[model samples]
Target: MFDYLGGNFPTIDRRSKKQMKDVEMVAQLLLFLEEGVRAYSQEYLDKAFSDRDISWDAKEEVEKEFCNTVKAIKEILDLSQDINLSKTRLKNQADFYSLFGAIAELNRENEKLTITRDIGVRINNFLKLVGDTELKNQSKDSLTDYQRNALEYYEAVKFSFTDAGTRKTRIRIMKSVIRGNIN
Candidate 1:
């Protein structure tokens, strides 16, 4: 974006010599930012779209108020700084600490889900390996039906994921992630 906007890129459309004006480009970029935010966070999108066509002044306020980025963060989320001070329900954005807290909460939840998904994949691979071993040994028929059924039953119980044992494993895995001891 910097290179293109700075006129450093050699590539340009041959069909049209005219490029978008600054205002048009800003509006398009803001719209894209809103769309991208809406995809991930409905709460942020609701706050962003609450105002009936937010003015440039509101955008300027966000740009000036927030840290880390210039207009990029402002484009994604339009916040009223005054409203934030008022403790209003229409506060455009949560404080940085609050937002980070929410992200940390989400990270834990996602970690649990990721661990469960990984375990599910491993269970599948284990079943395949066991089956292949039996086939290679030509010992598939040696095991009684009950033994084979027990192996299948173990798979079924583990794969249920909602079962007590699986739930415990999920908790353990989540804790491990928090401790930075993923294994």
Candidate 2:
């Protein structure tokens, strides 16, 4: 938060509602990045053939959607003087925290999706080894049903681990900024 001028001294305006709104929007963007795009890609991959290649064009489309959503949410954070920070409109730090609650929910979902993909990879590897005489002979009960099923499930699913934990931490840090505890 920056204040343009106050004599020779630069001023911090952390308590301003506008800044908090920006932080909230950033948090939402992070959540979406961590969850939404991954889910979309998974849905697409699940329907496609196991050996099929996901085109760069399709990847670009998902990226573009993410970018567009961020840009749209940024309007809430633009901090224009005309925008009102009324109490009813998430105009404070607590409201921002509430927004993070939503973010955490999304983060949880994203983690689940990641676990799905990891299990899929393990399953595929195990399937490959099944045909190898030496590997099959070494272990009959090595892979659990859960692990075996995960590979089979891979045919219908994909997952992405969008790294948004850093952003979540930043959102929490933004609180101290609101309270004038950070420079």
Candidate 3:
């Protein structure tokens, strides 16, 4: 959506249809990457243990790179440029692929963090359920605040990512959002 451009660029309706389509494709790709980063960041907040131990600076650096890449792509689409539409399309596609490669690397880094956090959460939950269950049952004391919070967060994250139906629904929503069909 052009709204994401933060008013940095003018309206694109005056461009040729082919150029418009190329710009739209670039916009959709950028939107998808933005959403992916946001979703992963939220999951990180919810599920991460020892968050201080993780280096989150890499995420910030990648985000800056993404912004710069988007800006460059937009500049290429500027109407004042004398380049032909076909040449612009080729350049845009090249830039898109470059951005895609950067996105892939960022995703790999995020996946590592997610996998580590998931393992830690699962282990903590398992220990509490098995080893602490008897103690909890024998005593009148309810689950500790920490235990309750961790379990709730773990369940939420697990259900969000593990269910086939949920995954399909999320995919549908993502597609619509990227296509600018959803607000």
Which 10-residue window of candidate 3 scores lowest in summed lDDT? 112-121
lDDT of 3 at 182: 29
- In candidate 1, stretches whose alpha carbon ends up further than 4 angstroms from where it belongs are 1-7, 14-25, 34-54, 61-183
* Top candidate by TM-score: 3
TM-score, cand. 2? 0.20
Better-scoring candidate (lDDT), 1 or 3: 3
lDDT of 3 at 21: 50
lDDT of 2 at 122: 30
Residue range 8-41, candidate 2, lDDT tens digits: 1111144643455443434334434444422223
**lDDT tens readout by residue for model 3, 1-183:** 244433323333445444565454444344344444233233443343235247554456556655654544344334323432223212333222433433344344454211223222332333244234454344334765444433433343345543334333333332222223322
**TM-score for each candidate, following the candidate numbering:** 0.20, 0.20, 0.23
Q: Where does candidate 3 stray beyond 4 Å?
A: 1-55, 79-95, 99-183
The C-alpha local distance difference test score for the whole of candidate 3 amounts to 0.37
Count: clashes, candidate 1: 0
Candidate 2 lDDT at 1 equals 19
